[model samples]
Target chain A: MDIAQTSPAADYPATARTTPTRHLERAHYDRATVHAILDADFVCHMGFVADGLPVVLPTLYARVGERLYIHGSTGSRPLRSATDGLDVCLTVTLLDELVLARSAVHHSVNYRSVVVHGRATRVTDEAELTLALDALVDHAVPGRAADCRPADAKERAKTAVLRLDLAEVSAKVRAQGVGDEPEDMDLAHWAGLIPLDRVIGTPVPDPAVPEGTALPGYLRHLG
Target chain B: MDIAQTSPAADYPATARTTPTRHLERAHYDRATVHAILDADFVCHMGFVADGLPVVLPTLYARVGERLYIHGSTGSRPLRSATDGLDVCLTVTLLDELVLARSAVHHSVNYRSVVVHGRATRVTDEAELTLALDALVDHAVPGRAADCRPADAKERAKTAVLRLDLAEVSAKVRAQGVGDEPEDMDLAHWAGLIPLDRVIGTPVPDPAVPEGTALPGYLRHLG
Candidate 1:
């Protein structure tokens, strides 16, 4: 395995903030659990306080070892506010299935989610910034980073990158089928899991693309 | 139409927090945009400050008219803290497609997201709580509320509901295909969109479910 790949699943010590306030059984503190959930999804909802009011924004992010990197225009409010090293909460959730129970009280979704709470520090070093950008590209379309030209001086200058060390992070997962009460077992209603998944459809070519350009090798297996 | 249903979209007045610092072209303040995105997604990431640190948790929610209702165990920290009428940020995002660009800088995801900032008020009135609970059930599976027995007084006593008026809200959408820069348009790489969608698969009946019970009408239409 490449060193750049997430290190083998290890354990992340649980802190007071990492522990779940309820459903403690569903909480996980393993490094592998957190990394697996984060790697499967690119979009994360990042929460931060601005003017004493909470603000959450959806943005793309990539993970490299103990750090998660998020990028955006330097002028973006969330990114700008994050550079000041303010406390932030980043969450990535993958909805696996919708559990439809015989009773309304038991309806729940099968999902895997990781939440990280930490202060986001700006990634200012030029070399690390380049690698973070590459990671972001590869995270979206694996192996496509090397195929395309890297961001030049101007493009790199326009982008802002923030890194949050995955310290106070926890993963919560629910993978079981419908979990209804024993009393509802005899109900004449259908109770089960409606597995939900996101699949990549056929690649649509750009209108101006060259006549013979074919879909890249990495994208052919996306779906 | 049931008055409980979200009313026809109108407009949400923009405030300082609702305004986007960048990508102004993608920011939408119209009520229609906000409601459409909110109605499509079931889980929302709610952010609130806990001990001066931002905490974001994924929770089930439903929309009724101008308010969003989130339900959870009263013992949960986030839910318990929210009842104090503290400010919160709630966000829902739907990932539509993957835009594979010719260059790394332009790679993006086509998505629609709504961000709401407000102080969440605890819902205590019994009549309104029933409506909110019904809305939550229907939000997960349309027509589900009538199919299953209503929550008993004991269940309702165990759950806590918080309502946030959709006052300061904004929707940001990116729906186009690959948007590579002009100079890189002619790059010899394939550039296009790989559409992504979440589809419900065949429902698996619970192991204890009766052998011949047919799937419910609501589950049949989900896929």
Candidate 2:
């Protein structure tokens, strides 16, 4: 529940901007926390300034090593900004529970989030791009990269992969029960935590799949 | 599965920024689609342009009428930027399914997301602030605003609510089975969709709560 614990050896150095302005106690710069929050999810909200205004878009991303790879088309606006090395902020959030407090002002939601502030550059190296693209598909369903048909040369030419290093990264988390002032402890309002979990239902196969083909082990484990 | 169904009568006017450049078929501007996507989720990723760079933060939000309100501390950096009317982009995303395609390039996630771009101003009107604050709490749980203790004068003074009109908004969705090229359909890969759902679990009551709370009627309804 506490992400504030110190881990000097493996923690990412916190800069003035990444140190957090409010709730300083909830920020964690440890590498493990940052990677865990990023690896557990497949989608992310990428923020980049365009034309002196901020733009946010939800897209598919995967964390590989110390850099995060985000996928998009070559003509997409967000990805195009990174062609010249754009100053971007990529964020991933996982909501654990909803905290209900005795007072309205104290009401909060329990969540774990990692924010990366860096220059996102369009990946051009052939080897790195191949690895990043595989990580993206495996992020959604592990081990399926080898089973599926790899992108051909024509398809790969149109895809754009942006890489942002995990240099200025910080994880913020809020967990545990509600917090209410001692004076309001006796209030008659109901107070507690509503836990939420994401569950995967049965998979429906496409009609075109050949008969007698067994489901992959990775997906079987997902069930 | 189609969000592009046109309803020009109720659609928001799309400007140069809002009109999508890629995947033109999946973009939707109808007010009902935008409101539905916003109402079904409580957490959002807010993008703000600070110091000529983009910053993304995860926070709680609520939609009322034609505007969206976000609550934050008065000293928070993101909220402070809005004191003089800042340009912001707020996004809410709902993941529906994971599409497994025959080819790696075609792998995609089915999602419903709303993006709002406009000027965000700090709420100074007392009446509107009160309503926004209530909506913030109720967004977590219906009928929660009246049940909990309202914020006192001191608490209200420290809280800041930023209001952003539902203008320049658009909803983009990808909801369906896997989309793979006809040539790759006969590949030996398993292709389908893994449906995802958000299920609320049993509420965990705080230890300090009254022993005989009997769980409020609304909470019983949650179960």
Candidate 3:
């Protein structure tokens, strides 16, 4: 994950609202910046307007090249509405640390996030759906797609996978420790960063497994 | 955090879109279910429509009783629009485990999430603002509010704190292990759950602090 910290002077075009009104310097429009954040996160919050009111749902997603794939039941409102070519916004955020500051007003969190705005179209083609589902599984656990059984015809019929192209996107990032004013820097309060991270613990095998079956190699090397 | 495992039969009404369309049985409107998930999560994705486009931003928030407090710069778009009594949706999600099943379609992530749709109003009264700021601080690290300096008049003027009542809210949760069909349960593949959690690491002291200052007791007690 060797990410270059260049400024947001890249040529990637930004949508009208994706441009940040406040902290404009924190807004990035590079494809590398967007791809890195998307690949690092497994879950995203998909926002769409249902009945003229905005609805946001947390769901699993995977990023393959410039496209993001999301799967859900055909009976779900979000999936059904998306298949009708409804506009949607998908966001992925990874919290890095808690920024403790001298002044309460300056307290904030350090995070990396990517927000994508576009129309989500359902994937009705069976061949593309197979590739999309494989990308999703492999995204969570690399190489696990080859290890698991493919979805049968009946299972595929009941599932709906929505695809969103990453054309209008932006990444707002804040990685600094504290942004306190000079006057409050000397205040007698403990100020630093408490790093927060999501870690994979020791894997627990299923009870139905044959006795003494060893864990897969890819899962062992995930962390 | 003693939450009852009751169904959604409670009288807490749900908005039109918050009603689950697919798994109606997984929706719970009890105040306990919503509060517990809110208390456990430190950040939330706030969804709002800005200039006819839906925008979602990840921000820090705190749940105080029936009210949720979110603070940001007065210059930020979300905070300014929220203070103007605009409609907004805030969602908090905690991923419990990754359910690995025999078939790809059955793979899912177990999680608990709460979504609130309501109007946000500005908190301008000085006393209430102080209390809200304290809650936001203590929410991250309990009992640290009194240990730090309060927001001065100038800092409060530049910051905006918005409050949203938890009236139209619902908690969608999936806590069980894999729900594979009976025919696929006996398939020759490894199946189990991999739990996920956020853990706080050893606090790195601020370089400006006096040498040999011990870590706070509350932070040490935090898992």
Candidate 4:
């Protein structure tokens, strides 16, 4: 049975598609790990077959419970084709650090990434669509949906959201120091990790805005 | 003729798959822009058709003029299949800022992303393979590839590098300020860009480093 129909399990049952072909030790199937990695990033690369060829597109996404919502215009080809349930695989990677090993082959990045494979269906129900839209905004910026004006009926009608259940999901992570070989440990080379992070910067308000529009509580952190 | 076969073209010939279906104004076909976007990021989401299904995997990559190289283990299934020329699409996105509009529907991210569609073949030639490996390491950390020990014969044989010429490629970028509607500009909501960037941190040396081992000059900037 598909895991989506059942209650949330402690771990996502790994399917053949979810299994890692390499670095088995870094693969993760736990629901917490999968969800956490997905929540950390707001954008995802969605791959889908078009004319029997693979196409990868970057788009905004949000994780709502056991389902992932991808935002696209109703006029988009992928959105139109997804109405018939398109096969899609979405991947999100958060690069944490650059691991510098003693040798070229051993060098790697410390990253938390999640790969989700599933068939996505277009969201149609009004209430669910509203929920998905708000979730999309809040996922990227907490409390952002409430701060901004809700989409009008016309705006809602023009937008399309695809929901892919997090049934076939797995997270692969490598968050450690340099994995230099024992023999290479004595090599005259620096081996370690260079920490990397994406940081939020100060807000740049639109100049046309009324003079004293206060920044919302959600954006005050950046202010 | 494919752009690779001819001398370097100013733009990649956009195919049916490379053209954006929506927001065509944001699509870029210039080779310089595409190359710059690919060079700025070391990691990309590689999409390929596996068993007639789409699979998106994150991996490190580097651009060598009109060609892009993806690194993988020799034993990896995708790498194995690429030896026979697998249809692949690789996408790299560098997020710049979060565009917070006055309305929910208009919210977006300021990003530069390049997508390449090609049939990838495994690089088997000794010179090209070595160049790909060095390019992969140098792309991620400039000047560091020369500082590390070159891979031995055994290690080189264990690695697989896939070459995908940038014939059908396009870049999409959104770099401007919040695109709020004129009517919504007066709305009592903050509308602007929240600048975002990934920054590199100081290096953390391995525990076994000798007492007097000096950090290389290339890494002194971080020190």
Candidate 5:
């Protein structure tokens, strides 16, 4: 649909020219709006065609500047297909809550999501691979790149990383409270926002870990 | 790859004869698990093939028992293709937190997700359509079906609800603490787990809601 240039941010219906967000009007999109949603997520659902069918796989991802780097084993079908210069669809979503309204018909949720359509190219450059890997690691753990062992040559060769430039991307989000009909307000139902959050906890070391290897400073009070 | 009968739940290598977990691991067959994950979610990525290329759309979804209903108009490409008996991959995920570890390589996120592969059929039966609509309403509001105005015949016919029977579905979850290496444990770095949870807040009614329509009891303390 060439969603990159045509899809409008706050005006989803005019952009997509359809009713993809009919039920939950708040969960609609624009260009730059969707990019910000995608940036908040660390994993994505990568979809591709295989043997004349569709396949979707979940994998960890990292955003490097404007490009998305997805790593997997070279033998993985999705990775292999992406590396073969095939078209791929990448999606990231954050489910904020399960909205419960006074009236069932007006029930909805609050969320943020992004979908990207593009052709992924296999990353082969040694330096780019190193930097991408580092970015991924750092994204997951801020200062762990210097603490852990780097991927050896064999490890690097066995792993496959695909780069999908965020050229054609669209984001959609739904936030706020329920939309109940005016007559249904005093139906003796509770209505309000139940905020969902992700919090970091105390780390549990592997049972076989040797003593004296203290936790890194960045990991102490992380969210 | 057919994941229906493959089970190597113990971190073993994938083998041809491996029996996939018949219960928790077999993501495509369990209806309850699929509905549980879907009910708790707010967004999903619908993956399909268009013009010999792959495309993914981020959209809202609602679950009604064994059938998962996705709503859209009659003109959407993916919806149209699904109505034609094409296989579709729908994925829903909830990201809990960013796992920070002592070592970069050990960092990961705590998440729960479900991926389903099936052919979508256009909902045509009147009884099923009504039930699906009610389920969609209840999915968004725990006790909403009884409070709001029912959809008239015209409203029902205008909305296209695509039904994908719960078939081959699996839920993959990674939770708990970081996975630090033995040698990196005592490096004087703080290590712990970050907990992520979806919290439901008090519902807020639309400004135009009439007085005396109290909130439903189930929604008062919903999770």
Candidate 6:
């Protein structure tokens, strides 16, 4: 990611203080901290305003070198707005677990998230299109890019891919132990961190798979 | 839950056409589908317009009966705008898995999400405030409502809670096997469903916990 292009204050202001902000003293902004949070999740909620109205849409996304790619049909309204030079705000969150504490006020959740604000440009070049598609493949399944059939001309034309250079991005994360109030220490309440994780199960072969197709190495050892 | 107050277009438009219409599929409007998806996640990206500019913020959310409650400071910009009667868009998504397929076009992720558009009303009633807080707790950890100390008047006064009745909500979901094209089935590539799950881990006790506070039943059996 291009850390040099990112301006934290421009993307995340300290004034947006919600009650959650008070507990956000431990949140970090380092790139490694941010990317770890982003890489652990698979979906993002893209938010934007069109015609003076707030619109939030859920879409699939992949992180390539320094950019995030989002795909949608050419007919989708949000995609059309984004392709028309609109500024977009995108956010991805990975909810690690529910932090249960002895006190109600200290109760919290452990999560990691990245929020990026930028103008999205539609990917039109043929070379970039192929690369974006391949990046997306490897993003979901490591090493699957070379193994899959590449998109043909007709297929490429039907899909709309938008790229947002991760220029002004900020990552906010809350992890570790519960926050029990000092006075609640003596209360007979169960207070601890319930670590949450995303695990992949055994692959279920497609019923229509050819007689003897083998499972890929990546799938066999997916984290 | 007040189902009648929910969005009029509660069902998604489903058609076999290349692109589905805006108003036909159950995936678009079913309250159960929408609530299930919304309640399963922990955070939401809230979008609203300020000074004709778009802003998106990530915040924790809890669903109460038929309403979604999001807590922020009394002075927050988006919360202030929402209280001033501006329409806001709130979106929540749960990423289930990374779908790695043999074909590039078939690459996708399994997810469930709900997008709600409505005006947010600042919650003021003391009774409703307590209920909302408990609901928030239970939403994060099922059955946590009875385990923690109830919020007193002072704590409630310090918190700014806003409720957006679950009106005008739409749920969109995509789950199941990959959408590999017929010709790509024999491409000698691996194809199958990699299930994604959120697993809860062993609890970590708070450092300041009293000598012998035991874990509560709710914390022991969390899903």
Which one wins on DockQ?
A: 4
Q: Is candidate 2 or candidate 3 better by lDDT?
A: 2
Write one digit per residue (lDDT tens) for candidate 1, span A17-82.
Answer: 888887788999888788889999899999888777778888999998888999999888877766
| Tens-digit per-residue lDDT, B118-148, candidate 2 | 9998888888889999999888788889888
lDDT string for model 3 (A35-92, tens) is 8999998999988876566777898899876788999998888777665776888999
**C-alpha positional error of residue B175 in candidate 2 after TM-score superposition, expressed in Å:** 1.2
Among the numbered candidates, top TM-score falls to 4
Candidate 4 CAPRI-style tier = high
DockQ for each numbered candidate: 0.78, 0.81, 0.65, 0.85, 0.36, 0.62
Candidate 6 chain B, poorest ten consecutive residues by summed lDDT: B14-23
The lDDT per prediction is 0.85, 0.86, 0.81, 0.88, 0.65, 0.72
Off by over 4 Å in 5: A1-32, A96-106, A175-194, A199-215, B1-42, B96-103, B175-192, B209-214
Q: Write the per-residue lDDT of candidate 2 for residues A7-93, one digit (tens) a residue.
A: 435888899889888888889998888888999888899999988999999988988778888988888888776778989999999
* Model 2 regions more than 4 Å off: A1-8, B1-9
C-alpha lDDT of residue A57 in model 5: 67
Residue ranges of candidate 3 with Cα displaced over 4 Å: A1-11, B1-11
Error of 3 at A93 (Å): 0.5
Alpha-carbon RMSD, each predicted model: 2.7, 4.9, 4.6, 2.4, 6.5, 4.3
For candidate 3, the per-residue lDDT at A26 reads 83
Which stretches in model 4 have alpha-carbon errors above 4 Å?
A1-9, B1-9
- What TM-score applies to chain A of candidate 5? 0.83
Instruction: Compose the digit string of candidate 5's lDDT tens values, residues B133-175.
Output: 7867666554667656666776676667888765566666666
* Candidate topping lDDT: 4
Task: Output DockQ, candidate 3.
Answer: 0.65
